[model samples]
Target: MRKHLSRVLLVLTIGMCCSISCKKDTLNINYGAITEDLSAYLYAYTSGMISKASPIQIRFAQSVVEEAKIGSVATNVIRFSPSINGEAVWEDTQTLRFNPSDYLKSKTTYIGTLNLAENFFQYP
Candidate 1:
C-alpha cells in the first residue's frame, strides 16, 4: 500500500509538471512592427499582363518616404526615369501608388529600384 501511494504521487507530480511546462501558448504577431535585428528593404511589385496604355501601379511592403525616387532599367541596359509626375500615396501605412505621366512600353522588361532616404530606416 505504501509503495502504491508513492507511485501515484510521483505520477501526479509529473502530470502536474507537464501540464504547467508543456502546454502550448499562442503567439500574437504584429505584422506592422519591425523588430530589432531585421534588415528593412523595399519590395517592388508587379501585376501580370498590365495594360501598356494605362497607368502603372507599384506597391511596396513597407511605408516609404513620399519623395522616393523611382528608377527603372529596360532590357537595353539603359536606366531612365520611368516614374514621371508620380505621387507616392500611402494607401495604407505599407503601400505606395505611383502614377506616371505616360504609359509603359509594351512587352518590355523593366527592373525597378526604389531610392529610400536614409532616415526612412532609422529607428528612434
Candidate 2:
C-alpha cells in the first residue's frame, strides 16, 4: 500500500494542486498551512492512485464546500468528469476521502476527467 501510495502523487506541495496528471488510468488535494505531517500523512494515506483500490484523500485548511457533491456519483457537485463512483467517507472533519467501488480491473482502462482535465499518473 505504501509503495502504491508513493506512486500516486505526481506533484507534492503544501498549497495548490500543482498539476493534475492526465491519463487513461484510475482516479484520485488541498488547503491550509499544511504541515509536514499532513503531506506525509497524505502520501501514506494516498492522495491518489491508479489501477488500485486505495482511497484518495484531500485535506483542507477550512472545510470543503459541497461535501455532499464530493464522493457521490449521483449528487456530486465537485464535477469529476466520467464521474467516479465511490463512497464519500471522511477521515476527519477536514479530510475527505474517496474510495472507488472497484478500481482495479485487469483489462478495463478507466478514463476519468476532472472539469475537462485528465490525469496521466500511474503505478504497477
Candidate 3:
C-alpha cells in the first residue's frame, strides 16, 4: 500500500512539474512594424495597377525637412519609365504625393523611381 502511494505521488509530482514548466502563451503581430531581419524591400508597399485619380504616395521611415527648395526638389525625385505628367507635393513631413493631372492611361504600366540623393532629402 505504501509503495502504491509513493508511485502515485511520484506521478503527481512529475505531472505538476511538467505543467509548471510548460506554458501556453499567445504572440502578437504588428502589421505596420518591420519584421524581417534583412529584406530586399524593407518597407512594405503595394505595387502594380493604381486606381484612376488616385494620387501616388511615398512614405519615408523618418521625417524630413521641407525647406524652401522642396518644391523644385520634389519634382526631380520621382520619375516614371513611360513618363507621367503629375505635380509632386508634400502630404506631410514623411509622405510625398504625386497627383496626376488626369486619370492614368489604361493597360499602361508606369515605373517610378525615387531620387533621394539630393540635399533636401536629409533626415533629422
Candidate 4:
C-alpha cells in the first residue's frame, strides 16, 4: 500500500510540473503593450564613490523616451557639467551615457535631479 501511494504522489507531481511548464513565452511579443503618461526619472549608483572621470550612465526600469530626449532633459537638470555641452551616448535600448567634460570633485557629495525634483536614486 505504501509503495502504491508513493507512486500515485509521483505521478501527480509530474503532471503538475508538466502543466506549469507548458505555458507559452510572451516576452516582447504578444505580451500586449501598455501606454501611460509617466515621465523619465534619474537613477544613481551610490555603492561607493563615483570616479571623477567616469561617464555617467543612466538606466531606466522601462523605456521612457529616445536617447536624445533623456540627454536634453538631463542637461537641464544635471549641474555637474564642466562645459555646457557633453557627449550623450546610447549603448543599449534602456541605457543613456554621458561623458562629463570635467572630473567630479573628490569627497564632494553630488545629488542627481529629474525636472528639478529630488529623491530619484535607488539601489537594486
Candidate 5:
C-alpha cells in the first residue's frame, strides 16, 4: 500500500510539471524612429590694422538650431569694422564661404554671423 501511494504522488508531480511546461508565454514589442535638429555658429579674433591686403579667417563654434525647414541650409555671414581706436568703425557683409581665408581686411575688428534656416523638421 505504501509503494502504491508513493507511485501515485510521483505521477501527480510529473503531470503538474508537464502542464506548466505546455503553457505558452506572451510577449509585446514596439519600435519607432527619432531625429534631431542641426545648427551652426561663428568665431574670430582681433588683429591691428593691415598695411597691405591680409587674409583673416573667422572661427566657428558648435551650435544647434531646431525646427529647420526641409530645403533651407545654414550659412555663415561675416561682417567687418575697420577703426583704429576700436570706435566708429564701418560694417559690411562679406560673401558666404566655407573657409574664412577667402576674405581680406584692412585695420578692423571682424564679426561673424551664421545665417541658418529650418528645413523639414519642426521644433516641438
Candidate 6:
C-alpha cells in the first residue's frame, strides 16, 4: 500500500510539473487606427482604332474620404501635364472628370493621386 501511494504521488507530481513547465506562444493582432497618404491611377481609353487626333476619356476607379470637417466628403484632386518622348503625363484636379478639350495629347500616360480619409473610434 505504501509503495502504491508513493508511485501515485510521484506520477501526479510529474504530471503537475510538466503541465506547469509547458509554454505556448500567442499572437496578438491589433487593428488600431491608421493614418497615411495614398495615391491612385487613372487611365485614358479609346476604341481599337489608333490615331494622333483620337479623343481620350479620363477615368478613375473610386474615391474614398480620408478626412472631413462636416459630413462625408468624396472627391478627386488631379492635375494634368503633357507627355513627350514617351514620358508620363501629369494631371491634377479636385474634381473627378475632365474633358479632352481641356488638354491635347496623343499616346501619353497620365498620373493621378488619390487622398482618402476616414474617422474611426480611437481608444483613450
Predicted model with the maximum lDDT? 3
Report the lDDT of model 4 for residue 7.
36
Cα lDDT for residue 91, candidate 1: 48
Error of 5 at 43 (Å): 6.0
Residue 44's lDDT within candidate 6 is: 25
Model 4: residue 5 alpha-carbon error in angstroms: 56
In the order shown, the candidates' Cα RMSDs to the true structure are 23.4, 12.8, 23.6, 21.6, 33.0, 27.9
Model 4, span 1-124: residue lDDT tens = 3443333223222221111112242112121111221122212222223455666554544554554444343434333322324555545545556665665555433333222232122211
Q: Which scores better on TM-score, 5 or 6?
A: 6
Give the Å shift of residue 56 in candidate 3: 0.5
Cα error, residue 4 of model 3, in Å, equals 68
TM-score of each: 0.38, 0.36, 0.56, 0.40, 0.21, 0.22
Candidate 6: residue 61 lDDT (0-100): 24
lDDT of 2 by residue, 83-109 (tens): 456755555544656666765443333
As for lDDT, the candidate ahead, 1 or 4, is 4
Compare the candidates by TM-score and give the number of the best one: 3
Q: In candidate 5, how many Å is residue 89 off?
A: 23
**Model 1, stretches more than 4 Å misplaced?**
1-44, 53-58, 62-85
- Model 5 spans with C-alpha error above 4 angstroms: 1-46, 61-76, 81-124
Candidate 4, superposed: residue stretches over 4 Å from native? 1-47, 67-77, 80-89, 116-124
Candidate 4 clashes: the total is: 0
> How accurate locally, in lDDT, is each candidate?
0.34, 0.38, 0.47, 0.36, 0.25, 0.26
lDDT of 1 by residue, 1-124 (tens): 3443333223222221111112244223222222222223333333334454443433334554343333322122112233234444444444445444566654443333333223433322
For model 5, how does the per-residue alpha-carbon lDDT over 1-124 read when each residue is reduced to its tens digit? 3443333223222221111111243222121111121112223222233222333332223222332322232332223322111111112121122223333332223332222222111212
The alpha-carbon lDDT assigned to residue 21 of candidate 2 equals 35
